[model samples]
Target: MMGFGLSIEPQLWALLFAMVRIGAAFVAAPVFSAVSVPLPVRIALSGAIGVLVVNTAHIVAPPEIFSINTFLAVAAEALIGLALGFVLQIAFSAPMIASEVIGMGMGLGFANAVDPNSGHATPALGQFLSLLLTLLFLAVDGHLVLVDLVVRSYEVMPPGAWIAPQRLLNIAMFGGYAFLAGLLLALPVGFLLLCLNVVVGMLSRAAPALNLFAIGIPASLAMGIVAILLALPAMGDYMLVIIREALAAAPALVLG
Candidate 1:
């Protein structure tokens, strides 16, 4: 007669640590971290991917888990995961920022709705642009690319790898690009609205008793919508580039 029992191995510990990183990443990532997605589903996905990573990659387990060094290693892993996800978050936010600018310029700032992702009241234009970006993100399989980057990170950076301060600074600098991209996206519509405002001001000065508010508001709104529609194709193109750059940068940040 023989009895069999299960024992936890070093590889199992490595898998668990890997799952911690993956789960942290999903928690900070855009689509996967959406409020609509159940927490359990996110955990399952992290665990599944962690299993795949452990099976495919040669992950080195820390000699001890209940020690100061292991704690620091775990912290490092979580930071790497969070950095990877945060880069994508910054890229995704560019559309929302552009929408906000355009919405304000169009005199539609008052038309606010609850944002599905943030659960906060945002201008309707911002919501619309965010939705478009989200759809485009899916269409291009950006999520798959993100997952691939995270998976590849293990091989490139490995567990317990220390990220340098210069790399962190670079990540912060990368976020600045989002603001520039957003400004560029809104520039066409914003410029048109500015021109409309100037023209409206001139007309109001020429006719002292005329109601310019009624005319200016509608004109700006109409022109803004048209500008956005016309610029959409270009916006898509720019967003695709941003997404690609963000994905490409993840490995560098992690490996650093």
Candidate 2:
């Protein structure tokens, strides 16, 4: 019995390395990484997937479970997993950025509420947009894609593969795209509000006696809400692209 168990030690270590990457991905991925998920649950999920990876991928057995090389491979796996997770993390930032832009424009920035996902007091628009993005994320089955990508990583990079410099460059480059998408998501509402503000400024200039307070505030509020409603369909389309790009980028980030 002792010899039989010893013979499988290398296989078990390989599974351990695989779990490190998956667990790191879960810790870093957007929806899965939410503070709301208990650590024990995340670890368990990683373990389950790790078991699948070892069975399906036919990963090479580790040299020694307690050796320095095994530790290094585990660290590399974690790094790769984090890179995969960071791709989605970047994608999820778009809605938050848009929310901030629209919220500040609508004078809703001061209206703060606790975010259930993050437990932070974000502006009202941020909360609304977060909810919308969350819905869109689930609607597109992005969560499944995230899981699939991590699983695919085991096949592509496997354990003990060298991390390439270009992959790190790609991760950095992806951040630029994330910021651009965030701006694009926010642009419609932000621009419309800017136009509204200009009109309000003109009104204030033309008639100093006009109760700009009474007139402009309600006007901006109504316009902001209308703009958001008008932008909804486009926002959904934007999210579709964002999720696709994020999922596609995951394998590159993890494997490279």
Candidate 3:
């Protein structure tokens, strides 16, 4: 403390405590949480944001770092951070759900690929749609919006204060939105594919000798491609809406 013009202990402690929230948020966040994102990068980014938080917000670290109160405070910070990120994660899953419905409708459900972002096997169409959503999310500055929500959340929950149990219940309740949004997103293509399937069924019954297996797959595949292309604009627009709604919902978790 003597060597430096100003004391660093208090400020440094606050910065470290602030980083805990930012890091937890990033760990659960989408783009930032990708398997490809390195650990050092996450730490660096969280640390950078934490500094901004310390400068602007009054984040006082616990006086006794080893006390039970400090432990509770850290847990609270992590809980708030997780809630903020998990809300967006739920929204992002809609694209995967929509892809699943449309893929099955188009007979592409068997085609699977590893999603580079999540490193999990998903239907090929799901992978494509998820990537599109990710790009659109970045194009619309969603990551920055999410970050802003995280920063402003301090005004709502602050550090060391436990989040209300009802808010956690609400976050859990948001799980249903994904299915509803996904079905809506898949409706257009799915409806058209349904018509095609019905027509194929009629054809199969009319010509008993005609191998339905050979004809059905090709017909469904070709029509599915066409249906997807036709529905592209609406899907893109819906994705933007999803992004907006997801961002809008995030504030509700922390703010009144």
Candidate 4:
């Protein structure tokens, strides 16, 4: 008796397509895209998730992987993945924006450091806020929620489906909210800094012999640190809301 060979054509196609989508999402998303994450580990994670997605969804394989139609479908999958990840990235950037505003106000804008997450030069204050947001993101299990959204997207928007124009519009509209959230996060400290600057300016004008530059910098730094400590709890709450909204928006981005 001869043993039958298992057909791997459909499974292979499903895995390839799934991997493309998952890989694209990870490339654009935060946390997973951090410079600290090794490339090989990222690839392995993507492949593993792709395998699970393909097996669970039983996604239909394209008639021919090398055909123009199949190529377009792959491109569509990639676009969907990118769109989903970009939404979260925008949301996560709120803290960075707020930090820049507060840092400039506090005279810490010049204190530059290399950000481990992005591997770029950023103000020390900005880096601190970014780390705070990152911790909040993980603490709330935002990453797992994002993965669940991506997996569910396969059911709502199967392969080969094109994203609607309205959905793109919604995403663009949704991004504006991130700026608003950032502004809210920075406002308390920014206002305090502004008032401090005004007082410093008045004192400088009133006393010619006093060294404003030396005095202002140190005072701003001390007050800013105090303000940050006072505002940390509020900032964490704001970040959680932003994260939840971003994850909520992910479905609309991919499924619509």
Candidate 5:
């Protein structure tokens, strides 16, 4: 059966083919990739996005449905999608890394809980920053922006076309940026904690009879909490900037 002189079968194939990339992107993306996100929901969303792409963009179906070329095309599609999502994943990791440094500095490193995103045990502070980052991600409708990039990516690098080597280099470069960003994010609180530790050390040297653990532990914990509260506003702003910059860089890797 044909609709308006167009075969429905080919369109269905194109739709299915489109889903390969969309599905892979969802699997690798941040919020969408969380353990809390159900598999069925991911499938539905991928199908929905695939339908949108097929409707809005012109996609050609492979002449042969079963062949080596088709398998290669599938791999290319997955690669592109993973690269796109990996960019945001790198961005999200900055907060976790920052939390680890701050927690250790404040003697709160042992406080661990399962991360909702990856299901691994993360520092309590890391989890907090991760939640904050998640909120910021939604507040900016970053998911929508990422989906838009996924769609636009088809236009720039269609299925079967290889991804740019420069984009892979960009991802590697961005990993270094994540470390730098995390360090900067923790700098304020870490600095205060360092000073607190130094003072505690001096006090211990002054009074040998004083129980260093009893005094130093409490002081470090109290000071860490206070430093965090005072530095929170600035840290939040830094996260926002990181989010925006990441969003900005993501499109370049995919579209440009």
Candidate 6:
């Protein structure tokens, strides 16, 4: 076999080894790395990027591709990629979490629909939040930034390099921030709904025949929409935080 008219040798093996990292990350990441994306498409994307990585970085192949040591190094690359993708996965969970909080409050928690993007049946509120967040994320060119982050990973953690244990610790640690960010995003809506619930309960007590169940649902729905609109600015800020944290954690995940 030959590449670019040159005979395939040990040097070509470097590209193959490096590709495992890119492929694993792309396959596991959120947004562009979702399972909803066709496997063939994901593979094609990784291959295209791998080609560019090889030419741009001039990565050198191992002495023996099939040897035990070389295989272990390749495995290392795969682990790094998985870690990187997982970090992004955690970031994307923010919307789902916020939606859960909001949905439960709005009495919409049981209303679920299959999400085309993630291929899961999520609450309607969760699906809406996810879709809106995705649109906003794209509007900010987050995809390009993500690609840049992936490219930089090669520089910070070269192919076949062993990841440090602290990096794993860092990945676990970042999960704490996920909860914080999710709660912050959902707080305003949650609080508003909580107030609405209290008012509805008080009204039901004053007039038993008013049928609280019938009145509360529409009230909650309208209140939820108004609350969401009011909270939009804060939600955007929370999303930015999610993105920043994900990018910051990417290196640790990839190199750990």
Query: For model 5, what is the alpha-carbon lDDT of residue 25?
Result: 89
lDDT of 3 by residue, 1-256 (tens): 5856347777887888998889998988789999999999999999999999999888889988899999999988988888788889999999899999999988888999888889999999988888899999999999999888889888777887877888888888999999999999999999999998899889988998999889998888898999989999999999999999999987786454
Per-residue lDDT of candidate 6, residues 96-158 (tens digit): 888888988888888998888877888888777777777777777777776677777788777
Candidate 5: deviation at residue 198, Å?
1.4
Highest-scoring model, TM-score: 3
Please write out the lDDT profile of model 1 over residues 1-256, one tens digit for every residue. 1222224566678789888778888888889988888999998899899999999988887888799988998999898888889888888888878988888888887899998887898888888877887887898898998888889888878887877899889888888878888998888778888898999999999997888887988898899889888888987788778777777777766565
TM-score ranking, high to low: 3, 5, 4, 1, 2, 6
Give the top-scoring candidate (lDDT). Answer: 3
Each prediction's number of clashing residue pairs: 0, 0, 0, 0, 0, 0
Runs of candidate 1 exceeding 4 Å displacement = 1-9
Candidate 6 Cα deviation (angstroms), residue 28: 1.8
TM-score of each: 0.92, 0.91, 0.96, 0.93, 0.95, 0.89
TM-score of candidate 4 on Cα atoms, chains taken together: 0.93
lDDT of 5 by residue, 162-221 (tens): 777887887888888789889999999999999998998888889889998888888888
**Best of the two (3, 4) by lDDT:** 3
Candidate 1 at 178: error in angstroms? 1.5
Candidate 4 or 1, higher lDDT: 4
* Number of residue pairs clashing in candidate 2, backbone atoms closer than 3 angstroms, sequence gap of 3 or more or interchain: 0
Tell me the deviation in Å of residue 189 in model 6.
Answer: 0.9
Report the C-alpha displacement of residue 56, candidate 3, in angstroms. Answer: 0.4
How many steric overlaps does candidate 4 have?
Answer: 0
Q: After superposition, how far is residue 66 of candidate 4 from its true place, in Å?
A: 1.1
| Backbone steric clashes in candidate 3, count | 0
